[model samples]
Target: MLTSAIWLPATLAAGLFQAARTAIQQRLRATLSVNGAGLVRYLYGLPVALALWFGYAAATSAHLPPLSPTFFGFALLGGLLQIGGTNLLIMAFGERSFVVGTAYAKTEAVQGAVFALWLLGEVLTPLVWLGIAISVVGVMTLSLGGKGLKLRDVFGALWQPAARYGLGAGLLFALTSIAVKRATQTLGDGDVVLRALTSLVAVVTLQLVMQGSYVILRERGQWRAVLGSWRTSMWVGLLAAAGSAFWFTAFASAPVALVRTVGQVEVIFTLLLGHFYLREPLKRAEALGLALVVIGVIASVVGSG
Candidate 1:
């Protein structure tokens, strides 16, 4: 049987790739509108995902798994929720500092466990829950910043655009994780890699059709922007596909809650990206928060073991 050891590395890799992809997508926002930059992820990623799935199938002579209504239902719902979550995160970028925006969404790990339990009937042990609580405190420490820790400030921040969008994004993303996990389980007795790839292909295709159609009909100008920026968009797509492939594979191998808990390391990657690439200065509070996150992740891993 596959264990947390099997899935841990994939989750860490996904976090790294996802952090980089998000940084790229955030940069694209300067050149393109929110939805346009968002479209690059699915529109460009479709081909890469398709190629990987087909190539693996050809190499292994793996036949397509039988699809069921439950599979389509989960895939469709998860795909749509992810698109919404992505846009909300992008929109958060516009409202506040990139690091803070991303940190707010990292709150998804805590909420994800609840959604996983409700939707998939997955439960966690006491130690794992302690790890999750520690991680949540770290994230909250970062999100509530020095100035934000005051009583009045905390209430005020919740109503602000960045906080509102970030929290909403977190909730939607939590739901998306649960849905995708359910979708993968529908492919009973299939190869882990094949199951992950098949689900990714289907989800990405659905996103392209739905998101692409919206861009064309409602945001025609953004459609042109998407075409004009193919060079950078391609990088965004490549990273998005790589990150998602790792994520799906990890989900197939382990419980979604544990995967997401470990996935919180994306906060560390985001901090590094912000400091080095964007030249954003790290505040003392942020530095402390980062240290807490590392501790939380370590505790979570040990607990899983």
Candidate 2:
């Protein structure tokens, strides 16, 4: 019911938040590459996400699901993997524009559907496969449309650091999806509070670990950067957090695979924002790619139904 209840609202929220995030990513891409800067931004975003989840939990009087060491461990591991994936994506953004970076992110839909079938024993009908195929085509169209690269050139670009990173992120994102579902099961609460709380703790814990480690290493002596980054990036982080929370909250009610597959709407949001706000050019090839992805998502929804 979360999806139906807040589906349009959540999607709209994700769109607005991602728009801002894309703008920040493009600005950072101008000077900083995605790897380091992207990671920093993700870490910064976690706290904002935490605050939102906490606020939601308090307002709803949502019950906390019971926790065990095993559950906590899974949450931590999944959070780490997701953060790592986001880092890879940031690196990808450095290589290309937000559109390409987002197209790469859509790979998670296919990855997640497969993982759900394998790990959660979730059923996928022929229609689901069709949807996946269509979505893949759309994603490919999006990625290749903007650049004038031929088919071979596009494949060759896969070897680039950013593409590799994006793929890596997608894989990790699939893993994160698994972890979240597992976390949801552990809580045994149909409400979104427990899941939100678990994610809040997990992300915050990881954020601290990553930041603390950096502080200890004095790697770049970027305390000034951290402080400055927080001021500019906190809200972006909050929006991403809200997006994550709503997504999983929706997951609490919907089929995990369906939720994730449909959630690929983030790519559409990212690409549109990339073009409108970041002024990233949309080429014929990319337009065709986007069309393919949209068609695929439609098929997926129908297939899943």
Candidate 3:
């Protein structure tokens, strides 16, 4: 029988890989447009995703899982939302510092809990809910930064570009998480790895087709930019594919809410990456917020475990 224990490690790996992918994609913004950078993820990752699916199938001697209408519907919706969510995140990078923008996006855990409970019927324990609350407070603290804890500044911060884009991105990401979980469920009983790879291949292919068409029609000039940056784009593709594989596998193994809440470790990873690599300084409030996030993550894991 599959155990939720599998999701803990899978989600942690996904968080680390995703943090690296976001950092690389942020750098790509220098040479490529938002759409261009986003395109590189799906366009380049398609082949890698296909290879992963085939490699798993061949190694296990597993045949292709039969696809159902429910799977296609959920996968397509999830793919589209994921593309939108990614672009929104890229836009947030332009509006705020890398770590701060990512902090705003991390609000997905709170929103994801609501969506998962409502749409996926995955209920959370009281302890898990407390962990989610603690993590969300930490995220808000990060958004506030070193500003005075005044009501006006707090309210005004939400209207800022970073908050706007990041919250929107979080919402789309939450929806995508629900849809992807639903898609995996539709595959019925199977090897969890094969089910995840199959869903990843289908979702990535749909993203490429949809996003590629848009890039071709409206942003034709960006094609040269995307290809020109193949050196860096390739890294983005590799990390994104690796991260997504783990994410899908986690979804198959555990509740979406639990997976996402634990995935909050991405915020901590982003903080270190921004400080050491990008030379972004950490402030007092931000440090406190990071501490809370860490504590919350530990609580969440224990609660779920």
Give TM-scores for every candidate, taking all chains together and pairing residue i with residue i: 0.95, 0.85, 0.96
Where does candidate 2 clash, by residue pair? 45-237, 131-300, 134-296, 135-296, 138-292, 138-293, 141-289, 142-289, 145-285, 145-286
Residue 42 of candidate 3: its Cα lDDT? 91
Highest lDDT: give the candidate number: 3
Q: Write the per-residue lDDT of candidate 3 for residues 75-162, one digit (tens) a residue.
A: 9999999999999999999998888788788889999999888877777778888888888777777777757357888789899998
Q: Is candidate 2 or candidate 3 better by TM-score?
A: 3
Error of 3 at 77 (Å): 0.3
TM-score of model 1 relative to the true fold?
A: 0.95
Candidate 1 has an lDDT of 0.86
Model 1 over residues 1-305: C-alpha lDDT tens digits?
24435588889999999999998888998988878988999989989999989999999999888899999889999899999999999999899878878888887888998888887787787778888888877776777764535677677777889988999899998888888888888998778878888999989989998899999999999988998999899989998998998899899888777888889899889889988988878778776777778888888778766
lDDT of each: 0.86, 0.66, 0.87
RMSD of each: 1.7, 3.1, 1.6
